[model samples]
Target: MDNLLVKTGSSLKTFFTELGGISIMVFKAFAAIRIRHNFIPQIIEQFILIGKKSLPLVVVTSAFMGLAIGVQVGFQMTGFTPHWIAGGMILRTILIDLGPITIGLVLSGRISAGIAAELGTMKVTEQVDALRSFAIDPIGYLVTPRLIAAIFSVPALLVFSNSIAILLSYVSCNMTIHITWNEFVQGMRYSFYVSDLMTSLIKSLVFGVVLISLGAYFGLNCQRGAKGVGSATTLAVVWASVSVFVLDYVISTIVFYA
Candidate 1:
């Protein structure tokens, strides 16, 4: 019983410690932007890497997601439910929930893992120390640009994902339930809310910040050699994914319920 209590206390300590570290890193990342000129090129590079390179995967994933949602919604529409409502349901689902959630989870895996691995490798190799030795602030040179790029690129990706998903959803609705384009558009127009769009964009921005901050924290604080890098990468992906869902719920609650 004593051992169990001690373990629980230790776990709580570690959790809060890590949380504090991540919070500090996020602050420093934003503050580091004052040195933006030094890292402007890196920002652009990361933008392309995070946004342009991720486009193909987003397209494919959004297409399938839309089709799946459309088909499922259509199937559920028995007799009482209006066929036109399917369009609004699909659009709302994609924009308000699925769109940002999907992008957040997907990019958390790819982006967070990659950032952790890259930075962990540098740490293990003492490259981060080398930056210090050269009087370069690693946070400024490394974390800030990635943070900036993610903030911009994530929303961009979400927009693209939402667009593609909605389009494919329309197509699927047409094929599966025979919803005409005009009917789909009308349904969407009626159900559309500016708040929903704002929620999506806010979620995307927060998700981006969360992913990069977690990734950088784990990577910078990595244990040791190759094994440490791998572990950090895994933790980054896991934590980033979990954080996305948590934040999504919190944001939704505050926006819609409150």
Candidate 2:
């Protein structure tokens, strides 16, 4: 019992310590931002890296996600429930929850791991030290661009994902239940709201910040070794994915229930 209690307390302390470190990293990232020549170019490079590179995965995932939702909706339909209702269910599920959450989780694995590995490699090789030796702020040059790119790219990805998912879900609905495009769209129009769209965008934006910041924090603070770099990369992905779910629930509760 004593050992258990000691372990628990130590874990909590480590959690808070890391949390404080991440918070400080975030502050430093924003503080270091400046509209210099390198800044724009770096941001553009990140756009290609974060946005363009991520597109194919988003497309494939959203396509299958839409198909699954449509099939499930069809399976659950009864005589009492109109077939058209599938459209609203698919739209709401995609926009209000699944779309942003899927993108967040996917990017948490891809983007977060990539960021952590890159930075961790640099840290382990003393490249980060070299940057400091040159009087260059690593956070300014490396972290800030990624953060800014994520802010824009994540939402753009979400929009594309939502569109593809909804469209393919309609196709699936047609194949499953023989519903016309017009009927499906009518149901979507019936249930759609400006606020639902806003909720999705807001969630994507927050998810972007969480994934990038956590990745940067873990990478920059990694221990000194190849094994340490691997550990940081794994931790970054794990924590970013968990944070996405937690924040998703929080955002939904505040936006829809509160």
Candidate 3:
């Protein structure tokens, strides 16, 4: 029993220590931005990597999501409600809520996982050490760019995704339920507010930070060799996804009251 207790305590200690190290890395990523002119390229590169590259997936996924929601709402409103109202409500719920969250998840799979795998491989191959040898800060170069990308890209992706999703919703309604574009647009205007948009943007930012931080944390700490890189990559995605959920709840709580 004492041995088991000791092991448990040791595990908890390691967990917190890992968390602290990640926290410091995050702080450094933010701090590193103030040091130089390199930030502009980093920011631009990040915008492309995290946002531009993600557009196709975001658009395709969101469009389908919106379509599915429209269909489901139609079934739900079968007897009692007007087609236009149901279409509008679905569009509202999506733009105001699911749009950002879904985009964040898609990003976790594409952006976060890519960051982890790339960095983890670099670590195992001593590319990170190579950066250190040149007096280049590896964290500054690799980690900072990714952090910037994650921080900025999420909201952009959310906006892009949300817009596309709404477009799909409108079209679906028009085709199947005959909701006019004029009425659909009006419904969107009525149901969505600046506050809802703001709340979703906040959530996307939180998700972005969490995703990149976890990826960097795991990648930077990867053990020796190929297997270690793979393990780190896997852990990065898992932790990033879990962090997304936790942060989502925290943001929702704050938004609900704010």
Candidate 4:
């Protein structure tokens, strides 16, 4: 019992310490954003890195997600409601919960790991310190662009993911339940609302901020070795993924209840 208590206390201390560090890093990154010569160019590069390169994975995952939801819902709704109801159910699930959550988790694994590994490598090799020696703000140069890119790219990705997921759901329903495109479209129109769309966009935006900021924080604070870099990379993915689910619940409760 004493040993367990000691481990629990140590874990709590580490958690809060890392949380404080991430908060400070987020604030600094936002403050570092400025209209400089390198800002736009670097942001453009990061947009390509974060947004474009991530498309294939997002597309594949979302398509399969939609198909799975469609099939499961279709099976459940059989003989209970009209085939069109399956379309409505699938849309609601994708838009309100599954779409953002799926994309967030996937990107948490891919983008967060990449950011942590890249920045951790730089930290371990003292490249970040080299920027300081040259009188350049590494946070401004390295972190700001990625932060901005994530903020913008995630919403864009969500939009694409939602659209693709809906389309694939429609296709899957057509194949499995003989629901026509018109029925699917009508069902979507019947159930869709502006508020739900807004909530999804807001959730995606928050998730983007959380994942990228945590990744950068872990990477920048990594210890002095390859093993430290590896640990940071692993923690970056794990914590970012965990944060997504926690934020989803918090945001959903607030949005739905308040």
Per-prediction TM-score, please?
0.97, 0.98, 0.89, 0.97
Model 4: per-residue lDDT, tens digit, 193-252? 888898899999999888888788888888989999999999999999999899989988
The clash number for model 1 is 0
* Ten residues in sequence with the least summed lDDT for candidate 4: 71-80
lDDT of 1 by residue, 1-258 (tens): 999999999999999999999998889888878754657889999999889998998889988999899888888877787777888888889888999999998898889999999999999999999999999989988899999999999999999999999999888878887889998898999899999999999999999999988989999999899999999999999999999999999999999999
Question: Model 4, 18: alpha-carbon shift in Å?
Answer: 0.5
Deviation in angstroms for 180 in model 3? 2.2
Q: Point out the higher-scoring one by lDDT: 2 or 4.
A: 2
What candidate 3 gets wrong by more than 4 Å, as runs, is: 1-14
Best by lDDT: 2
Better of 3 and 4 by TM-score: 4
Superposition TM-score, candidate 1 onto the true structure:
0.97
* Ten contiguous residues with the weakest lDDT in model 2: 71-80
**Model 3 accuracy (lDDT, Cα):** 0.79
Q: What's the residue-level lDDT of 215 in candidate 1?
A: 89
**RMSD of candidate 3 to true structure, Å:** 2.4
Question: lDDT of model 1 at residue 109?
Answer: 86
Residue 131, candidate 4: alpha-carbon lDDT: 93
